[model samples]
Target: MPRQFPKLNFSEVDENVRLLAEKVFAKVLREEDSKDALSLFTVPEDCPIGQKEAKERELQKELAEQQSVETAKRKKSFKMIRSQSLSLQIPTQEWKAPSVNPVLSPATPVLPSAFLPVQVPYDVPEFQRVSISGDYCAGVTVDDYEQAAKSLVKALLIREKYSRLAYHRFPRTTSQYLCSMRDEKWKVEDEVYPDFHSPPEENEDPYNLDDAPDNLDYVIKIKGGIPFVYDNKEMMELNEPRSLPYPDLETYTLDLSHVLALIADGPTKTYCHRRLNFLESKFSLHEMLNEMSEFKELKSNPHRDFYNVRKVDTHIHAAACMNQKHLLRFIKHTYQTEPHRIVAEKKGKKMTLKQVFESLHMDPYDLTVDSLDVHAGRQTFHRFDKFNSKYNPVGASELRDLYLKTENYIGGEYFARMVKEVACELEESKYQYTEPRLSIYGRSPDEWQNLAKWFIKHKVYSPNMRWIIQVPRIYDIFRSKNILPSFGKMLENIFVPLFEATINPKEHKELHLFLKYVTGFDSVDDESKHSGHMFSDKSLNPDLWTSEKNPPYSYYLYYMYVNIMLLNNLRRERGMCTFLFRPHCGEAGSITHLVSAFLTADNISHGLLLKKSPVLQYLYYLAQIPIAMSPLSNNSLFLEYSKNPLREFLHKGLHVSLSTDDPMQFHYTKEALMEEYAIAAQVWKLSTCDLCEIARNSVLQSGLSDKEKQKFLGVNYCKEGPEGNDIRKTNVAQIRMAFRYETLCNELSFLADAMKTEQISALSK
Candidate 1:
């Protein structure tokens, strides 16, 4: 049975808790508009007065806690548990891969070891381990430690609830610990995973529309931005929708408030901050002791290496998938080959490719990479507005429309050709894969069908490329132009067609086929821009939000998440592919954006803002949520290359992968994903194991199917720890995998111990 989350009531929430959430939101909003934008990306520093005062308060509190006899007894008990946990050895499991033929006839000859299944050794080669003993809670009072542990656990539970509700992923290890805390048995069947469609076979048709499931008599209506499914028109009239679990807005806001308040809690902040520091230091010590052993292990592995390990560019835009040189050459080649061919229409006059460039007072033959002016530079740094303009070639929107858009007069032929060319390069690379985001603006209902036709007409299917529908958060622009009457209408335009297609695929064959290759949705836009409205239960529903002012970030995430959740449930019931919400978050603006994403996003891109809040960062680490970082893209628009926290986050055991956000604007080479890895390796002095580990992470974080992952990583790729890692396939050291697994288990053990103490205290009471 699927786990059901308890519905929350807004009125039941304490006023003080609500006030605290409001304060947190306001603080982050002010920070977003502050001149010290760099501070958001770096660790905040306290002034001398505040630092002294904080230290004095902490010291006084510690002294008082030490004098309490009950506190002393609790501290001693905690120390004992910590010491015992530290001394206990991690359980080892021997994984022997099953033979190709389990029952072989006596006449059959034995297969060679190479031909046998790949087996991962659970008994990792012995290496030095870091152990700390005595007074584990020395730095903080036992009471404070327990408080932080309980709060962190509560936050994790909240996230788990959301992940399960939306069919997003939760770490198996963390889920097990959480189950133990609740005294409930965790089962493999309880695990919920998003369903992604696998690619078609070589002999099969990629664009086949005949295999769509039979239509059902389902009615979908978008009311206040939430999709309601009814059995038929009579049920719709009766207001009795099907019993699919729809999220309650009040409950969501209440959950959001809990996380918001957690980030502001003083004790939790200190605990998480210290733990993060310890993690970083612990990694440093582990490296010093076992660096060579890890390298030796990797060296002995056969065939696999950093270059050959499968890596996916998890975050990139379709329009800029091609680099400046590629785009420039394509433009010139089109002009040289088809100067008289009609490519666009403007002012009711058909125009040739040559005429389009001539209108802009330019000739394609004279164009160079520099003159194309699509590449980002120093001027673009910290200036997203200027960086966006770089999308237009030679400072002409006409050229952008002619070559980049999918709805042009020529049915996006030129744009499709360019994207296919980029796809060809990725196919040739063989080891590289990319999930490029294509736009889905909610200005009209026909947008989905148009995009689908464009895809089929161009035969744009690529085995190496998966698609993500990126909905740009520009409702204000549309609303201002009267393109949309209200936010509810926009939501309907975006999601209704998808629901319609899911119900009646025979009528929407093109869209149903296009959606198979699309594995997820992305909420994208400039994060630096701020909206004055704060999202709350009292906030206007989407139907009432007719103002030109854009809804706040939280509002957008919530509505998007709810719609996707319902959509996934519907699709899952029909045995179809489900989409993950991988939004762009934490790149800029308020740190609260990360909070919203914690409950809503499956994984996020550009989590640079995680550096600002230790509590949120620790939560992200515990959940093992994947973050796709694009440093080169950041260097051009937001943070400097050296200041990026990808290295720090990676060292701290955060699940992170490298990606090229925009190859056209930020890259010089044809291989943009490789360029990202090469620079990181050079700058950070990363080891071969580190690069392979990152590559392995990219594959895991991608939308690739389970079958594909098994081929790339191993058959048992879903298992946790060293048992899951196939050193032969991944080229990652078993020693490193064991260390990571042990460290995480150690952290979870502390939380579990805290819960046990709470149970005992309640029993005593």
Candidate 2:
């Protein structure tokens, strides 16, 4: 420093070293000279340093100053952007997209404001001809539904005392309820109060205990499916809301498995523990029934109730809620039928109700409220749907995580392996060509590209296999993550290529199914609403290709309507039929969304909620667009086990088929449909014959050729008996044969007791 460090040779040092040397030299100049400038550094006319060297230093100093200014500017801009973005009043989740420049840094860029969907001119021409006609359901009539309803009612009313049970949870909202209207209980409270007694006041009371009403035996007739209470007092009808009468638009299945989710761990495990408490009420059926009825003052709400059944044809329950013995059987069955099995894996353990109930709380030493306090426990179930909101709605953040984690594997070797697995499954099922369905809501262009490649490779071995895919936009905003791909890029870079590869010049039939999907538009918040796809030039925010925001499918309702209607003229030009599978469509059934789908739907998935919209249901029924319902998915998401709308759809004479949506995620077996059928069978209490018809509908609704469909159905139909010859039905019948046989034996025993009781009456006469 004393010698001025030989003028600090920064030029000889590397870029990083020179930067350090520059800082050191500047500090020395400030500390040593203070006010005096280092005249040697400047390019003076007489100085030893040349203008060339001085100019280079000056240029470097200018560059450094520019960088410092930019750094300060960027910091201020970032803070301002965040402040402004967070302050905005958006109805959905709070969001911000920083306006970052890629040239400056490799950071995230501000997402463009949601782009408006491109609207077509009124004179746009159509490209594809869409059609759905000439199917087995074409013969179904309203009269057929009425007859089926009648037969179903007759079957339900086979028991005299309880007669029937049905479920209807009206006031359907985000937070739902079971509303015992869907159980065997609905008959007593809402329809016929056979043992109803007007409560006693202290003054008007005799003993309050004796104030209980006497048994009132009433045989109610169900006409048009529902029994009108008008005869009790025809005058009350005028003031009351038009009553929804009952042949009870209800479907019973044995499996609550689809509808009821088991909380494995975490704090939410408390909900599962509470759910298990329902089992303790298995002891005193009458006491339990009272508890089930006591609390709720249903003065204004007359739609839910519990029924007393002397007969047990349809009362058998696996949850001990109905036929008490079912709880123990269901528990044992679940264990015995481990893994792929839904039947007994070994001989029964024969654990009695008392033994199991004791094991629940394990208070064998406690005296008061001992394990099965049927009286107290039943009260807990009165609001059976208390936890409806507990674990239902999946957080957007969670789905975003899935997208992020899923992206790395989507276009890699894992993709190949998944496709190979599908190939193997097709081979196992003995199908020449099989279509495995996938949704494009949370996917990137690479994912679809990878799929196309693997599919092409697979087609070498399986020529007949068809690749069917669905693309839909269920969310309006793009989450700030590198998981999802945007709508525009997907179409331009993904779907267009996939489709181009699929369509052949001579025959445009390489793609077996093209499902344009739209979902999540029926949101409560307007900000979160994404009714259609937003058309954006994704080229701007190019930090990630796979994380583009969701875009619309060619299947948005309004877009679909215009396209399909326009396509009608193209039928003569190209003899091609187009199909679309729009699912998660129950609530968003506008004339455009639902009615429009009639033109192109292969089948609609999760049309369970379609029952609410009568017009939509009728339209789909008229169009013969089969409803592919996944009971387990519905259970995990919505609808109580007893409140499954599949039965209602079937009763409406809707073309319906059983399906397993996201079976692996829902933890269903490889034969996912069977588990669905199992749950549907349990909660809806369906018979083997009904299951066969449902199973058959799946094949009927398939997008197979006539010959293929015929061959498939032919192999399924039973030749030996009145029932269908399908192996699935055969298996169900065998498992259920025990239940039916047991029912028959119990009925005989009851009949024998009745005969013995009546013998004295005949003698007295």
* Tens-digit per-residue lDDT, 117-233, candidate 2: 213211101111111223211222212222332322222222111111111111110001111112222211232101101222336522222312222121222222122222233
lDDT of 2 at 403: 20
TM-score of each: 0.95, 0.35
**Model-by-model lDDT, in order?**
0.86, 0.30
For each candidate in turn, give its C-alpha RMSD to the true structure in angstroms. 5.4, 36.9
lDDT of 1 by residue, 1-765 (tens): 654457887564545677899999888777667657555566654421237778789889999988887777777667666665554434423324434312111110111111122253354666777877667787777778888999999999999989998889999878878887787877777888888899999999999989999999699888888999999999999999987775688888888888999899988888888888889999999999999989988887778799888999999999999999999999988999999998887789998878887888988888899999999999997788899999999999988888999998888999999999999998998999999999999999999999999999999999999999999999999999999999999999999999999988888999999999999999999998988778989999999999999998889999999899888888998999999999999998888899999999999999998988889999999999999999999998899999999999999999999999999999999999999999999999999999999999999999998889999999888877777788888999987887888788878878877777864464334
TM-score of 1: 0.95
User: Which segments of candidate 1 are over 4 A away from where they belong?
Assistant: 3-5, 11-13, 45-50, 87-123, 759-765
Error in Å for residue 320 of model 2: 32
**Best prediction by lDDT:** 1
